[model samples]
Target: MTTPTSSTVLVPRIRGALAHSDRIVLPQSVLEQLLSEAGRESLPSPLTFRVFNPATNAYTHCGVREFSAPESTVLISPQIASTLGVSEKQLQASSTQDGSTPPVLLVSKCDLPKGTFVSLCPLDTNYLTMDDNWKALLESALQASYTTLTEGQTFSIVNPATREAITLLVNNLQPEKAVCIVETDLTVDITAMSEDHAWKSVAHRDAKRKVESGKVATISQDAPVRGTFSDLSQVFLFDLKSWDRSRPVIVELEVLDAGDSSERDIDGRAADVFVSIDEHPSKDYFLWSTQTDEKNVISIAPSNSFLATAEKITLAVRSCVVPLSFSLMVSQEEGIVEQKSAPAPQSESRQCPNCKQLFPPRTFQLHTAFCERNNLLCPHLGCGRIFRRQDGIPASHWHCDLDSFSCDSVSTKEKHILAHHTLATCVCGESFPSQQHLAHHRATICPQKLHICRFCHLRLPQESRDSQSDLLAGYTGHEFRCGTRTTDCPRCNRIVKLRDLDSHMQLHELQRVSAPLPRICANALCVRVIDDDPAAANSNSLGLCSSCFGPLYSPMHDPTGARLKGRIERRYFIQLTTGCKRSYCTNPACVTGRTNSNLPKLAPAEVAAMVKELTEGGKLEFCVDDGMTRRRRLVNWIGDDNEFARPWICRAVGEVRVGGEDDDPTSSEAKARSWLVENGVRITEVR
Candidate 1:
């Protein structure tokens, strides 16, 4: 669709300009300018140019003999004016400095030989018709062109270059040989419409009473057509372009269904008739009947509250594509129209056992059934007593702990329900009443089944698109690769998901291997000052533990992988005199614990051996804890995974040595004392 190579400056027509009957009088200056625009060596005699009419979609070779006016302008005859979607008065009208008469906007974008039709219809109408009656053509069609026009018939016309179309209309028929000539006003007959478009609007609907030319319009219901009609309430056909009737084009109309006069409601408003997508009686989406403004138009989109995706709607609507015609009837509601409704009676009520409150008899069984099963309390205001199940009846006695249970709660009752009530479980591990429910959930609500566009944040289920060509165009960003994808860190051995590679490369902390020294800050960061750090190692604030003992270190993979020391420090109390176990059970001695029978203490070597046997047998594990401002030991591990450790192991490892400075952490006796208490063992018989 390239543009034409000619530009014309239109000027007003004046009297006594050497204009011929068929030729458009033009000045020499204007003619030369136009020829130059067309890139011609010389102007052709009776020069011809192509013009476009968007409304009637007509494109033909038209000649220009000459032109006129003081300034460079184009003044064509009325016939040419009408063909180009402009009025004759427009080209002939005088232009002031302020442009009293606005210039027509040309649709042509270029000044080339084979030009494009770039003009729009000056008139509001996007459509028009042609007929053979010369007299009538000028009268009705504004002298554009005509073939033949009959009443109550539709015709298709389009601008070949612009593709703008009009479904031509002829409301009433008049035959040449008719013996009887009726004097009634004619109505506008809608012959056909373009495919994939919707039509509505009370103004267009009421034009049915006007002539096919739409010259005369009225609001009367008196004009009769050849049919037995009942106030325009019918399912009209939509002339689909194709023969596939899988999903019909939905007609949305808002109207009031007038009921019998005696059954009218107190408000006198008409009963609204509507269709629901979900089939809920009260949740209707499409209006069945109604009246509105004359300008109201029908919606071409699918029904509201429709669960289908956009692609589904486009495909479904396109499946029933109708390129030719569709049925249309509009009911105008100038004011409120009332309809009557049948009376509805109330149901009988009964009492509840929990609160002795009244409920409808029909709903009482359902109300009590679930309550008794779930141990629910009376929901009535001011009543909190629970209901018990006794022979299918709700017995009262306890209170409801409603907050303690939910659908996901795995209680004894829920376990019993799952094992006994449901026969199958879904892939997501949820129980349903029947296979049908399970299948529906899997198809519609399953998280695993949800399709998300990797290119964007659009989460959608599987569905088709509106146009394959359109889908291919505009965007090339969608990528849908699923499942776990991991890659080894380029710098470190740590593995990371492919998508998180960018963030993983940012870990500067993993670059260094740290061997943490087992020294407390005494700065209150440690739960209890386990022990003061060696001045040399504590200065750098980076090292590994070598002093602590216990199984708390297991499970936690220390990057440095430090091994256990042969002997660890401990709290040892030599017996200066015999004393009760409770006397020493306050601090570190509590780690050793007590028993029903009195026992003697054990040597450190014996205690260490017991610890070795128990831990090696997979009986114990350990971990580490950092201290906080007011609290020490057992900090929450939620922020970091490594903070989780066995509580008993930490208690055993954090021993305050009561021995003389002469004792060393590597001493077998010291290790023995710590291991016994760490395992909560009494040194009794071994001593």
Candidate 2:
């Protein structure tokens, strides 16, 4: 597929939609996509619509609707509105800022042939209530489709009666969300990550960049901006005020919290740093884009520098999806540098006698390491490789050619290298950066891009393109997935525009259930094309193969399918049918084992059964891994020999529970107190 541009799209997911109508309504964008795949050909008898949720890797089939679902919404009844006490009337009904009216809690009652049904009840009245501040936060979160807040984690809300955050945890926020509760142990902490990596608001930009009435005019120096994979939240806008338009500009980069450059360092840590300069008015257009390595200081020389441009530079970073970014604006007035100078160098100061400059606090440690004038000799004893303090400062990533200038301090040596290093020029008479940068220039953005995409009619300006055929590989693989592009044929010497390939080829990915192109059922023995073949979609097939249809794994139709499907008789046939389907579950005892892999593609119910057998029947050994919950067992599971499970788990309620729990812990109060003290928890009370 052609690279999808970075974007945040809001796709509405409706719950309780079936509560009001037989047909499922959806936004125009979603409907168009659905029609493109599922609703393509002739409408089937007793039409069905299937939707696959990639997040859960599951599909939902609904009864079809002939007319379009209008206005990017699913409307519930006014009575429902009264029931919910929420109205999206003020939310513009936009795809982004819309939400469900409210939530109705459900309880299960197992009193049917098929099984238990989860129906709403008056006693299941624990919905949600929030104050104005919380309401805004929740609204914003829902708009962004935040996983934690919208997924029914117990969010402590301000109690209207007591004005205190309540500790009531809510559950089952699916399809749509409109309820909340206080956080609990079961409430998954979606924000699980290391200190360096957490989804959080890190930095703030000058609001004036977009809105004139923006409160902040400049990026907060104190704040560190954070970005994501798609959004470059941190962009440092730098204005080149140099009078000479043709002259190149130098850009400096500083890594914050880039651990100690002193004795120990975190320089080896992997970081994806993007440094791109805005070249043209077109948003995605870029004049220059390159990445940096190492955490130490470095300066980049870039051409095509402009003056007073609204948007200029950007600094976005990523450690995969967890992204971080920071913005900076550089402005310099003519002769302004001379006016805002520091005090003259003093002999008593950390400033070396020869360098005649003051060191920023961050660099003082490194600067003092090799400054011979201040008598701070290299830590490497007897290696009298010293230089005038003048040759050191602003550690640059340059290496010295001379072997004599070997200072033990890395920063000091780096400075000397830059001072003594010579610039290399390209064949085009353009001065190139150091060797590595020159190599990178040769690879990407090398003015003379030869290999071109025949489809996109675009030049491949990346590294190392061998022959025309090698470049064609990229065009065919990367450029020609879905869109239209202009391609030039090498052998035929002909240029033609390519049409959108998705129009004809997208049926293979059809997820929704409706009438469309022919497709063989996933079953190996069953070669049924339910859409194209009329007989395939009949009641006999149940719109699926005999084996698949027999499973009838729709939770919508059967609420207690697990208990029903797990019966011994059903299990034998189900395994036999699935065994032929694939290498999943080939236990000869259950079904005719086929294929060597013998992978068990257990259905949800089957998994629950296996787990039950393992735990209850003691079919497997259990230690820390709980046989039932699969979670680490409680500390009482801890023995005198079990060092790992003996420690008290800090419960959110502030109760310390071991495997023995609160009461059993008093029996081993001495042991518990000793353990607590060893772990640095003050032993306030043992009994």
Candidate 3:
């Protein structure tokens, strides 16, 4: 086996000969064309080959095949060609018949599957040399297709001869996964003089050991440690389990300059230091100045250790000092010492010349001058004392010493003569020579009196007399007096005095009565009597008496005429009977009863007219003597009376014919009454 020499493969022009088709066949001519194209291009070893089928608009997989140099016609394996649906002849013919040249076929290149081999092809050629440009074009086309495919995509290849296209599809394409990397640094510092100095270093070493041991290290404080720093720093923290560094926590410190005051006081000085740490980075540190001024001397615990630590840690302290200077002088000659003796004590007491009160000598003398100017005398009235003047003793300063009145002359003492005896009389006529006596008189000697009214038992000042009559007039002769003095007696018709009227009426056997009881008239008119009757008090016509029954059947007045006394209560009854004959109540309780001897006799003409109307079915009646029968008739009339008759009468007369063909010469009584009313007879006053 000799090594084949390299030669360029030429790419054939793809034209109408291999136009796209919906049902593509991989002919042996097409396979040979691919192999020839690969050899002529002198493509690199392990090159990719692809083929597209217009028939499914998809690429199909073909196995890798080795290329052997320039003029050799490449042949595809029978298995691969069969898988590709091509014949051996077609594969061989795809290469050149000329010894130095390569055969070609124009065919759609979309037949290969993604990442699968289709056919061997050269990487170099006229077209292949322009791979950069073509690659860009292909990428743009692929991007466009991919974008379209991603957005409701459908793909197809056009068959030039049939003018039809086949479709291809891919559901989804996996994207490339990403990996990210981040870096950080952390820094740390240690101050050996801090109280946790050894612990801090141990913690740091332990943390490192933990990292090496693949155990996670957490910086939880056993006790919080406070410290100070002068510059900015960075801190690092590491995750020992992962051995990964976290981002650096940066801390910045502010610089402070102490002025020229040199007394450094460190009492109660404090600060806070922040430290940050991260894995894969350094640690950062910062200082905060929290120091406070020392106000007073304060003793701190474990002073020696604290001072030593403070000195080593460069802590600021204030210095305070008080400076002093001294000088001394000495006299020449004898170096001597001196001694002295004690003085004797003196008595100190004096009495005031005025009151004889004892006091210290110095105080007494000082008070004496003031006492003399203000005339301070003894308050004892019996002594009648007066203070003596500094110049001459006054006579009033002498006091009486004798027991008898005539011999009780004032006597002089060493201080002064007692004078001006107190008087026994007080302004209020009480005697008191002293305030104590006067107070006793006021308490036991004053008099007071109060006066009261005798009648009403009301209290009043002794000086007021105006209320006497009002208090005296409350008595009444009777237990209850009558309230009516202006009203007349119903029986005697006399006005009774309010106070004596009840007793005066009792003399006449008249109890102070209310108005006499009301009674219905026994007359035919049945009038009601509201006035009191002395006669009815003794007699009975069912308590109505004789006067009301006398005028029953009188022709002088209409028997049915409404008596004024009765109509007072029967106005509406009268109005209902406007055109009808007046009604007569013949009940024995009425004045028109049969027993009334003064009943007036009616005329024969009147009796005949009433009898005619009564027989003609009109409402007319005459008083009769039958008591029970008359009562029954009165009750029936009251029951049967239609109070709606007046309006009926008005309607009948309103249709009456006057001087007309249908006129009646005989007028009805209603028409006569209407004529009378029209001729100025007052209907309301008719009696």
Candidate 4:
């Protein structure tokens, strides 16, 4: 953090107004005297500086960028004033106010250190004679154009498709001696300033990949050949190698010189010329492709599956724009030939109005003078092909007077007029017109595109930019804060959020399949339930309400319900011969609400034979209310019988509300003894 606040300034070279020579600018009162001598209020993140100069005593470092230069001057970049030898006529005689104290430099406030390895060296070898991948485009253009590296300082960069400047040379940094590449990551390397420039940059990148491995070649099966396309020959290959793994070859292709008319360019590049075949020329290994309109033909199939376990297929092809010509061939499929019902003699032929082919009337006058003087033919209209007049034509075949297209190369009509009339832009500031409409607006709907997130799985930018409550719930602000996390709800344990837990478990599976059912307490020994009070008291037969059949209420009119089955057999013969002595009766056919009082107490003729065998099969369910039969047999023997006594039985026969309480004018017995206290139905009561 070396900040003793030094200043001195005046190096001011600034040619082409700075776009990073490792940045500089300064002088707004020397950044307010180095932010008030470093107690700092603003200028820091990557604020560096250092500079030095004393007439080639050389020094460098840099960073800052814009304090609006002039006062004691600084400005820099003419490659940081030619790396400190500073003297564009001594910065134009110190910006002439008839004054001359110029080349001073020494600027201060440094910090430096963060470099983690650098190296660099190019100084020519045009990024090793560029075929692209120029060391990952010079490490993403030195991390998007430098912030400070220094060592021996050289810098340049350019080459956006051969604008060609290149330069480089920093050569070695690691832990210090001028480093701070702002937010560090460095590791670069590249090397070669001598070993005869690393053997002429690996012999000019192995003689342009040995002329791109002598343009692919191999091809065999049925012969047919012919080819073209050039900007260093856009792809081509061929191979196949003796197949026969149980027959199937095919392969085809036809075009024969086609280009300009399938119209495209605004960066989607086309203008007719197409060709494609694949097994890897990299459209991510696409397979068959064609496109030169008016039927240009293309094929592949030998049961493709990478040609049934490829030991050799290769093909490739590729194209897009160039002096496109084609033909190829391959053939194979045969085995299985028998039908000889005789009918063979046909080979008469004629056709050739200049390479239309079909010859034989005894070599139709020597194949029309060797196809009109070594073939040529193509005058465009439905383009037939031929070409070979010693391969000359394509120097700049034109067409597009703004989209009429054709273009064989003046660098494909200046890349089809800079991809369809120049405009471009988009790293997401969006502008378009070409580069194929900013690559179809960054591959369709570019809200800064990128994507991945699906709830913070991270890659980002599908742009809904969160919080206005996830942009009003349409989400994408990193999946609305990764759907605010939360969770629980495996069907209502309730916590929720993970993006509204799938509409909160789809509203609990739509209220568990449209809810309804649980009306309960028709007293199969009553574990309550009923009160959804639209003025309570549901009319009853024994769907009991009036306090569970109001102690067998009697304003009796019977209507052959055999007097309500003799009042439910006299309330189970008074709860089995005198024992409603209720201790919150847990009725196991109630003797004294039997909690197993050591059996044997029956006697009065076994209490009329246990009340005629517990009221025979008339199924008179034993009378309820002893605190709802001990809370319905303690929730049918302790809980969850389908979440609390589902259809509880132990002595059935239910329906017993004969005829009174005016057929339930909101029946009473204290509103059915607190109709399960407004039907909230939880259990716990037995005290």
Highest-lDDT candidate: 4
Model 3 per-residue lDDT tens digits across residues 1-687: 112222222322222422221122233444466567568675332222333333334333222233332242223333223334444454444544555423231233222222211111111122222212333322322322221112112233332112233333322322211000001111112123334744564575566444321232232212221222322221212221211112211121221211211232111111112111111211111111111112111112222222222211111111111111111111111222222453333456676776655677768878887766755564545453444445343333333353211111121121111111333443335555533344333322221111122322222112222334422542121111212225565547788754445556665443212212234333333222313345554443233334533332233543454552243223223222321231333322223332243444444464444344433442213233333233333323322433322322222232332223343434433453443233222223323
Model 1 clash number: 70
The CA lDDT at 227 in model 1 is: 15
Clashing pairs in 4: 260-406, 266-436, 267-435, 267-436, 268-436, 400-405, 466-477, 541-657, 547-672
Candidate 3 achieves a global lDDT of 0.30
To one decimal, what is the Cα RMSD in angstroms of model 1 from the true structure? Answer: 30.8
Question: Which scores greater on TM-score, model 2 or model 4?
Answer: 4
State the C-alpha lDDT per candidate: 0.33, 0.33, 0.30, 0.59
Off by over 4 Å in 2: 1-59, 62-245, 252-274, 278-311, 315-482, 485-687
What lDDT does model 4 reach?
Answer: 0.59
TM-score on alpha carbons, each prediction: 0.17, 0.21, 0.12, 0.26
As a TM-score, model 1 comes out at: 0.17
Q: Which has the higher lDDT value, candidate number 2 or candidate number 4?
A: 4
Per-residue alpha-carbon lDDT of model 2 for 168-279, expressed as tens digits?
2333333234221211122221231234322221211222234221112233322434322233233333223232333333332343323343332212221233344332
Model 3 misplaced regions, further than 4 Å: 1-516, 522-527, 530-548, 551-687
Per-residue lDDT of model 4, residues 375-487, tens digit only: 78767654464567877454455566555456444544675576568887765476867655565455434555444555544343455463476556666655666677787
Which digits, one per residue and each the tens of the lDDT, describe model 1 over residues 164-256?
544443333443211111122323233233332223223444554242322211212222111111322222212122211233233222122
Better of 2 and 3 by lDDT: 2
